[model samples]
Target: MPQSINCRVGCPESEAPNTETRAWSESRKMEAMPSRCLFLLFLSTCKLSPEVVAEVQESSDGPGAQEPMRLTDVQAAMEFIAAAEVAVIGFFQDSEVPAVSLIHSVVQNFQDVSFGISTASEVLAHYNITGNTISLFRLVDNKQLDLKGEDFESMDATKLSRFIESNNLRLVTEYNAITAIGLFNSMIPIHLLLIMNKASSEFEENLHRFQEAAKLFPGRILFILVDSGVKQNEKAISFFKLKMAELPALAIYQTLDDKWDTLPITEVLVEQVQNFCDGFLKGKGLRQNNEAKEKTSKVEL
Candidate 1:
């Protein structure tokens, strides 16, 4: 007959392994039991079906995983602009509809994004009355970023003047009420255009030097020479036209203004053009390489 057995509720019976064996066995069992309990807990907590988990695991860990493609510099900016195209420019109107307009815009001068719309548009009225809020989305291939910001009713004239000077933007006329009001109410994008005057041989030579430097790093230079003089000689105009035609890549130009306009050729425009050109070159190189690779692959296949 078997010996009478007495085991406490939490204690293992005598058939359990002896001393060291029992401890090891108990430890292993404890480990296994917890794992099993945890697995059950995981199953219960997950909302995903077993099939979905299996599919994801197979895709992520198996041969199906693929590296994501990166966007080239130009492509990234273009993608951003394309995505932001339909962005709303919101303006407050006391009248019937709180006016909102969708405008097409471009990211000009690298640093500031610009949009071209008529100054006399309804948006101007709204902006004049109660300021404005603009919202847009930026996307580069798979990446996305949203932009939302407000426009001030009036920017300081002195500040604007400084900005104009810094950016090389030549104002058509001197600081006047009309110009001030136009700037105050205008929703001109942050970008400014630089117009350089090529009145002298020295100026032309400097322009050429700048162009050469830019070519050393293509897509890294922008020079627009505007001939703004009362007695503009045909030789000078012809020379400018020829130069512009020759150096199509370099942003060279002559101004058409009879009165000397300084605002058109601001430093801000110069900086922006430089940055844009650099990005453009980089993007172009990437695209060309990609094309070459595709061609090679096709030939091999």
Candidate 2:
């Protein structure tokens, strides 16, 4: 957490956020660098990596619109999933089923989420799926979230969209009502959180560095962004004992142990973030463990 920005740097205390804590959206706040916030918006347009060599699921409508791809072989399925951080595969008995059409519609709606259709019995049995299912694969933590049973039967575009929103865990998941559930319920033990106001000017720089650092940990840690400026996010900031005054900061939360540590940061750099994560892994960043454990009960919810 930051103490105060120097007036010589153009940020004055009078202009800082008050107790009410309205998000600082003014240009003055941007001039002072406290580090930046995370970008991957938790909901931005997720772009597929152009460098991916595997053939992605072609959208049913065609590659012109980038619609869902039809997949039959298990090997092709694996390649489609491997091409992106998050992908959704629809396993149906056949393409004529009503659910398949509904899935195609829903797939078109979420451009950022990858989608594929598989009707082969071999593919279905490979995943132990007996019937129609929509599987969301998040390679970041190797978490496979599924939508099936009654929900899959009555699914519509709106319902399918909600499923993606709630379970779409990207490289750096942002903190919000939707993602909060996914994060807490995640089996991943340690969470690397970035607390900064998205409205801040340095948000892009900080987010880029955070993403780079995330690449180093993969399934080991889940990186989360908690925006200090959003009123709705005050609970998250407070959950980590952070004040909006401290616009940009990073913290590590160990869900298994209910402990956390705040990384003292003057600027958000890939190397610095990497060091913080490495230290935590080596069991060196638990100085505030005792203090943060008390709040673990609330976090458990």
Candidate 3:
């Protein structure tokens, strides 16, 4: 038997988890901070299956818009999270709980994240969530976060929002409208953007190797993936002065002072990526300044 969750008015829901991501394990380390979000990933829209594409389209079209989507069963939850870039799922047995209401309020403010709720007995047990919990899932690292326990219902709106924002990051967060909010709000001030063209033959190899490199620095740096072929991502690519010819590339950006460094690499071995990250951390990166605010304005979407 699973623990029962009770929810009242003004509570929230969460998103599903993709079963495809079995390579990683659970992480429970807690660190607190706030700053701007930065990281990018490029993925081909064509790579998504027809149903997955449809789910993304429906979400973009605002099918549930302001309200959290209801997860009737475990399969529904799985599909929802599998297709989302960032998702939160609330596993609760009661709709009258205060924490649920609080999360619901936060959901309305963060339009970029997908929120879903599951009261199903199997759904709660599947995630191993005892009591009422908010599980945040991110595609970047295939990581699932349990926001907190015991005192979750007592968290105020501001604290709840900040907690979600700061932890919103993952190992290799993708660049997009919804994800951009989390990327910029993260407390990590420095960013490493892996700009790639998914259509290129080299994309998969680089992605896998770079992910291992990203795992090396958790709180110290933000790793992002950006695809040059994605039209909407052109803003980030061009802002970094990355052209298709110059990618797949890796660039580091410091948000506090708006400085950046870009490097085009032919080989993406873990060691090379690790060296890149190490160089920037050791103050060896040739970071330059540009009109970042004016140029990145379009990323607010």
Global lDDT of each candidate: 0.25, 0.63, 0.61
**Candidate 3 per-residue lDDT over residues 158-226, each given as its tens digit:** 766755564465567776544454555445667788888888887888888888887777566778887
lDDT of 3: 0.61
After superposition, candidate 2 runs with Cα above 4 Å error: 1-66, 287-301
Best by TM-score: 2
lDDT of 1 by residue, 1-301 (tens): 0111111211122122222222212322332232121000000112444543443343334532221112123323233223221111222332222222222111112122222222223533322322332222111111111112221222233322322222221112111212222121112211111223455445555454444443333211223233433122223222222222222222222111111101112223334445554554344222221133343221110
Estimate the TM-score of every prediction.
0.18, 0.74, 0.49
Task: At residue 143, give the lDDT of candidate 1.
Answer: 14
lDDT of 2 by residue, 63-179 (tens): 623556777777666666767577788889867878777776776666667788899998887777787888877677665556677767777777677667656778899876555
Each candidate: RMSD: 32.7, 13.9, 12.7
Stronger candidate by lDDT (1 vs 3): 3
Winner on TM-score between 1 and 2 is 2
